[model samples]
Target: MSYKEFLVQLSEASGVSGYEGEVSDVIKKAFKEIGHEVTSDNLGNLICFKKGKNPKGRKIMLAAHMDEVGLMVKDIDANGFIKFTTIGGVDQRTLLCQEVIVHGKEKVYGIIGVKPPHLTTPEERSKPLEIDNLLIDTGYDFEEINKLVEIGDVVTIKRQVYNLQNNHIAGKALDDRVGVAILYYSLQELNKLQHDVDVYFVATVQEEVGTRGATTSAFKIQPDIGIAIDVGFGKTPELNQFDTIEMGKGPAFTVGPNIHPGVFNHLKTTAKDHYIPYQVEVAANHSGTDAWPMQVSCSGVATGVISIPLRYMHTSVETVNLSDVEKSGKVLAHFIASLNDENMEELLCY
Candidate 1:
């Protein structure tokens, strides 16, 4: 599938944290077409294995999460307004005035509503609005809404993924969905190359909630090397120097507690050898991605992270560059193909 098609389909799918069945189905079908043996872990991670010339040479696991930050209904007010609690971290300022999908008996449209400025006292308008004061208006009475909607249904922002100027793409859920697309394309590219190591392409679930899927799958796969593909913050007008990376430039190679130095260096060297553009990301604490779990699984796996430069992360209009996405896929495919039993041994020695 084309990158544009992949982005649209992933962005449109509602797979909030702990509810990733729909997104998993899409990923499963894509991997099946590439002739990989697909299976699911106990925590709902979709693991696809492609056997190499030497099945026992080494194991490499590439993971990308399939969950997005959204909301779950908590209560339906007497006036039919819906109250909710976030499934993952959500900025309250962005939630106001945004459109949303209320996943009720069937999908229903709703708008996040708040007291109008005219009604609010000047003192109230000056302070930041609290989440409890906000409500979702679905244009239905309390009895009617209760009949179609339940307390635990998911609620995602209603937005269409779009292509912006300068090869940038914008939409919701690009945080890890873009990672999912990159992994899928990389598998397709890897199929054309002759490699000596077995590779597992995993579509992990509940990463936003706490990397739950990766933790379980890593213990099961016990790979020699693990790489988590996810989205990183892009340069924005409001962010400071340390907070943003340039867009359309290249993918970011993470350096952090979650990454093994040997694996990171190998990836960087491979990128340099292939003349692929790449950026460096430094994280002092936990990297907050699937790599966090994969690095410490069992006896500990050598882990690394690659990220697509994304703007407006965790918002309705996240943005990414198409060229950056393609280059990330190619770089990963090349890195995997460059691995061999001897080289993998050298990685272990470090």
Candidate 2:
């Protein structure tokens, strides 16, 4: 499937942090289509294994999260209005009047209800709306709504991927869905290479809440090298240069405390040798991705991070450049092909 088509389907699937099953199914099918051995761990992480030419070679893991920030029904009012708590890191500012899909006994469409500007007092208008005060109106009366809606139902922002100028696209869940798509494409590219390392493509869950899936999966895999593919802040007018990487610049490989210097250098060299357009990301301490947990897994796994630049993170309109997404897949495939028995031994050495 094409990247655009894959992303569209992925973005539309509602897979909130603790509820990633829906998205996992789609990913599992994709992996199976490519003939990879797919399995799910007790923690819901989907692992796809592609055996290398050398059966005893180094194990390399590529991780991308399958969860997106959303909401969960907390209460159902007598009048049929649904009250919810933010699932991950939802921005209250983006909640007003937005369309959402509530996963209850049945699929229900709802809209966040905001006080009409004219109805709000001047004091209220001066302050940001609190999440506690937000309500989802499904247009169903109490009796009808109660039968279909219940507390604890997952809620996701409703959005479809839309293409923009300059090879960019915007939609919800691109934060990591795009990363997952990159993995799919990378696997495809790897099929054409003579890599000597076993590759584990992990579609991890609950990364929005924490790097929960990566933590457990990395421990189980005990990979020689772990690479976390995730979304990073993209440059926008509202963001400063130091805070955001540019979109369309190609995939970014991180350098920092959380990243193994040797692994980072390896990826950097691979990108340079292949002439893949790329960027550098500096994370002072925690990389705030699966890399954080993967780095400390087991005794210690040499971990690196490659991120796709995304705009408007954790919102329904997250955006990324498709060109950069494609580039990331190629870079990963090339990096894996470059890992030989000799270099794998030096992956973590200073």
Give the TM-score of each candidate. 0.97, 0.98
- Residue lDDT tens for model 1, 168-231: 8888898889999998888888978988998999989999988999999999999999999998
Name the TM-score of candidate 2.
0.98
Whole-model alpha-carbon lDDT for candidate 2: 0.91
Clash count per candidate: 0, 0
Residue-wise lDDT of candidate 2 within 31-112, one digit each (tens)? 8887887999999999999888876767999999999999999998889999999878888899898998999888999899
Please give the lDDT score at residue 248 for candidate 1: 85
Worst 10 residues of 1 by lDDT: 1-10
